[model samples]
Target: MVGDALASSPGGYLLVLAVLVPVIGMLAMPVMGLLRVRHAASLAFATIAVGVAVVGAVGWRVVGSGEALVYGIGGWSPPLGLALRADGLSAVMMAMAALVIALVALYARPQFAAAETAPGGRRAFGFWALLMGLWSALNLAFVGEDLFNLFVALELLTFAAVPLVCLDGTAATLEAALRYLVFALVGSVLYLLGVAVLYARYGTLDIGLLHELAYPDFATHAAIALMIGGLMAKAALFPLHLWLPPAHAGAPAPASAVLSALVVKAPFFIIVRLWFDVLPGASHEAAARALAMLGAAAILVCSVVALRQARLKLMIAYSTVAQVGYLFLMFQLTIEPGVPAWATIGWTGGMLQLVSHALAKAAMFLAAGLIAEALGHDRIDELAGAGRAVPVSLFAFGLAGLSLMGLPPSGGFIAKLLLLSAATLSGAWWIAVVISVGGLLAAAYVTRVLKRAMAPPPEGIVTSPVARSRELAALALALCAVALGLVPLQPFDLLAIGRAGVALP
Candidate 1:
C-alpha cells in the first residue's frame, strides 16, 4: 500500500526544514545587512550548509528505509489539507538542487560578497537573497503534494528568477528580463487555468487524490494538456525557448547556472508529476510520441544553432535547450501503460541526464565567467589567450564538455546509452538514430569551443589572472558530472523505490 508510505514517517520534519531554512535565510538577509553587509553572506552560507545537511538526511532516511517520507501539514491528511512527501525521485532532485546551489555559492562568493559598503554590495545582497528564495521555491516544488501548492512554488520561482536576469541593470539584459517575464507569466496563467479546471472537476488539488479520482475524460485531458503545455514554455523546450538564450547569456554566471541548471527543471518536474502521478490512466501513446518528436527537434536544431554562436555563454545557453530535449525523450521511451515508468531504464537515463547536465552546465557557465573575467570578453574567436590565462577554467570547460558530448566515463554517456538501449528494445529505431545524431552534433559544438580555446594567443593580447579557488569550484562540479558515469549501466533500483506498482500514464 502506497498509502502506508505516505503516513508521516520518522525524520519527516527534515522536509519542513528543507523548505523553511531557505525562506528564513532569505528574509533574514536584509536585516543582517543593516549591521554589516558581509553578515548576509555569512547567513546565506550557513543556510546553504544547513539546507544541504537537511536534504542529505532526508535522502539518507528515504534510501535507508526504502520508502517515501511524508509529512501531513498541521496534523491533517490529503484531500482536505496539504502534505509534503519525498520519494526517491524527489530526494534525488532536492539533493541535486542543494549541491548545485552550494557550489554556485562557492563560485559567486568573490563576486557577490558584501564585504564592504560598496555600490556592488546591494546587488550582492540581492543576489544572495534571491538565490535563497529560489532554493526555497525549488524545495517546495519537489516536496509539495498539492497542485496549487506547486503552482505557488512555481510563482515564487519565477518571481525570484526574473530579477536575476537583469541584476546587471544593462539595457539589453533588462529587455531580456522583460521578455523572460512575459513568457513566464503566460506559462503561469496557463498552468493556473488548468489547476482551476482540475479543482472544479475533482473538488481537490491534492495529487494523490487526483491519481485515483481522475479518469480519461474531456476535463482531465484538457487540464493535463494545458498544464503540460505551460510547463513546456517554462522549461524552454524548442520553439518556446526564445527567451532562454539572451536571458541566460546576459545574466551573471552564477545566476546563469541556476537558471539553466535548476530553474527550468522545476516546471518540467511538475510536468512529470502531472503526466505520471495525477493522470496515470490517461496514457496516450500518440501524445507521448509527439512530445518525443519535439525533443528530437530541440536536440538537432538547437545543437546546430549552438555551433554557430559566437559568444561562449550563448552557446552554452543553446546547449541547455538541447540537453533538455533528452528529458522529453523519456516519455516515448518509458510509456508502458501498465508499468511504473521509474522502473525503466529510459526513466533512469532521463533523470541521470538531468543531474549530470545540471552539474556540467553549471561548471560550463562558471568556467565561461572565469574566461571572460581573465580575457575581458567572451568572444569565441578572441579566446586565443584564454588557455594560458585560465587553464583550469579551460580544462574545466573541456571536462564538462566531455559529459555534454556523451563521451565515455561521463554521466551523459551512460544516460544516452540507456536511452538508446530503451529505444532499441522498444523498436523505436528513429529515437535511437536521433540520439546518435544528437551526440555527434553536441561533440561538434563542444569541440568547436575547445579547439578555439586551446589555440595560441594573438599578438598584443592581454589577460588577467582568475582566482584558483573559483576555477577549482567549477572543476568540482564537472568532476561530479563525470563521476555519475561510474554507476552501472542499468535501470536504477533507487529511482524505483517509491514507484513500485505505480502505473505509468
Candidate 2:
C-alpha cells in the first residue's frame, strides 16, 4: 500500500496544478502592473483558492479510494523523470498549508494594502509574490517523491521566506535576514552533500527506490546524519535557533504566520521521510535517543526563555522553538521493533503535533499582530488593558495558548497524551518525565502572558479598536487547533494508509 498510495496516476494532474498555479501567479505579477494591489490580491487569492480545492480533491480521493495521488511528469517514471506523490502525511500537510494560507490571506487584506501615492508598491507586491512562491514551494515539498526535487523545493522555500524576513528593510531586520540566509545556506549545503552522497552510491534519488537500496553502511549513515543535522538547523530545533526569534518576530504578521506555521515544517517533514520511509533500519535506537535528547533540551530551555520575554511576539516566537522540540520526541517513541511505524501512537502524536502547532501558532501570531496594531506595541508587561481593549484577539490568544500548554480539549493535549502513553508503554521513563516537564514549562509561559494581559491597568491607557472580521479570522484558526482534540485516541488509519508494504523492522 505504501507504493500503491504513492503510485503515479492520471488523476495526479491535480497536484501539478496545485503547485504550479501559485508559481504562475507570482511570475505574472509584473505583467499585471496595471492591476492595483487589491485587484492583484483578489486574482491571486482566487487562483490559489482553486489550487487549494484541487489539493483537497486529491486528498479526498486519497482517503476515499485508499491510494495516494501521484503524477509522474511527462508520463515517465523515476530513474528517467520526476514525480509528485501524496500519501496520508503529505495530503494532511498540503491541506493544512492551504487552509492556513487562505485564512492568512484574508487576515492580510488590510495589512498589505498599498498606499495610493505609491502605485504597485514594493512592500505589497513583494509580500504577495513571496507568499505565493512560499505556497508553491511548500506544496512541492509535500508531494515531491525524489530527493533532488525536495532539495529544490527547500531552496525555493528559503529564497521566498528569507526576503519576507527583511521586508521592512530596517538595519536590524536586514541583519536577521542575512543571518537566516547564512544558516539556511549552510543547511542547504549539508543537505545537498547528503543527496550527492546518496546519488553517487545508489544512482537514483527517488525515496521509494532509496527505501529498497539503502543499507546499514557507513556512507548511508553518514548521509542521513548530514541531512538530519541540516534539517534540524532549518527547523530551528534549539541550539541552532539563534536566528529564529529575531527573524520570526521582525517579519510582518502575515509573513510570520507562514514562516512559523509552515516554512520550518517542510524540512522536518523531510526528516520524517528520511527516517521512517527511506532508511528505517539505518536509523537505530541510539540515534533516535540522541535527537530526542536535543529536543528535550530545547523544550526545557526555550520554554523558560519564552517565559522571560518582555514582548508578546518574542514570547510567541520562542514558544515556537519549544513546540518544535516536542515533534522530535516522536523519533524516540516510535521505535517499537516489531510494529510498523505508522501503527504507533507516537507516529500519530507527532503528526498531530505538526498540524495543530501550525494552526495554533498562526492564530497566536496573528493575534499578537492585532494586539501590536491596536496598542502600537506588544510589550507583555504593559498588556494590562490590552485584553479589555481587544477582547476577541486576547480570546484567540488564550485559545491558541491552550494548545501550546497542552490543556484539555486542545490538539496539543491530545498529541502529548498519546506520546506520553507511548513512552510509558515502551518503558521509556525518561521520555515520559520530559514530556510532563515540558508541558509544565509551556504552561508557565502561557500563564505568564495571560496573567499580565488580564490584570487591571493604571489610568489613561489608550486602547485602539481592531476590526471584528480580523478577530474572527484569528479565532477561527485557533478553533481548528482546539477541534483536533475531539478525535478519538487511537492509531489514525488515515496516516497508515500508505505504509502497508514498507520494509519496517
Top candidate by lDDT? 1
Quick one: how many clashes does candidate 1 have?
A: 0
For all candidates in order, the CA lDDT equals 0.90, 0.88
Clashes of each: 0, 1
Question: Superposing every Cα of model 1 onto the true structure, what RMSD results?
Answer: 2.6
User: What is the model-wide C-alpha lDDT for candidate 1?
Assistant: 0.90
Estimate, for each residue in 1-505, the C-alpha lDDT of model 1 and write its tens digit: 2443445788888899999999999988777656554566788899999999999999999989888888887667887678898998999999999999999999999889755377787788889999999999999999999999999999999999999999999999999999999999999899999999999999999988898888888998999999999989999988899999999999999999999999999998999888889875645788899999999999999999999999999999999999999999999999755667877889999989999999999999999999999999999988888888899999999999999989988998999999999999889999999999999999998888888888999888889887899999999999999999999987787777676584333
Model 1's TM-score against the true structure: 0.97
Error of 1 at 282 (Å): 5.9
Model 1 segments more than 4 A misplaced: 1-7, 35-38, 502-505
Model number with the top TM-score: 1
Model 2 segments more than 4 A misplaced: 1-7, 34-38, 115-120, 280-283, 501-505
Worst 10 residues of 1 by lDDT: 1-10
In terms of lDDT, model 2 sits at 0.88
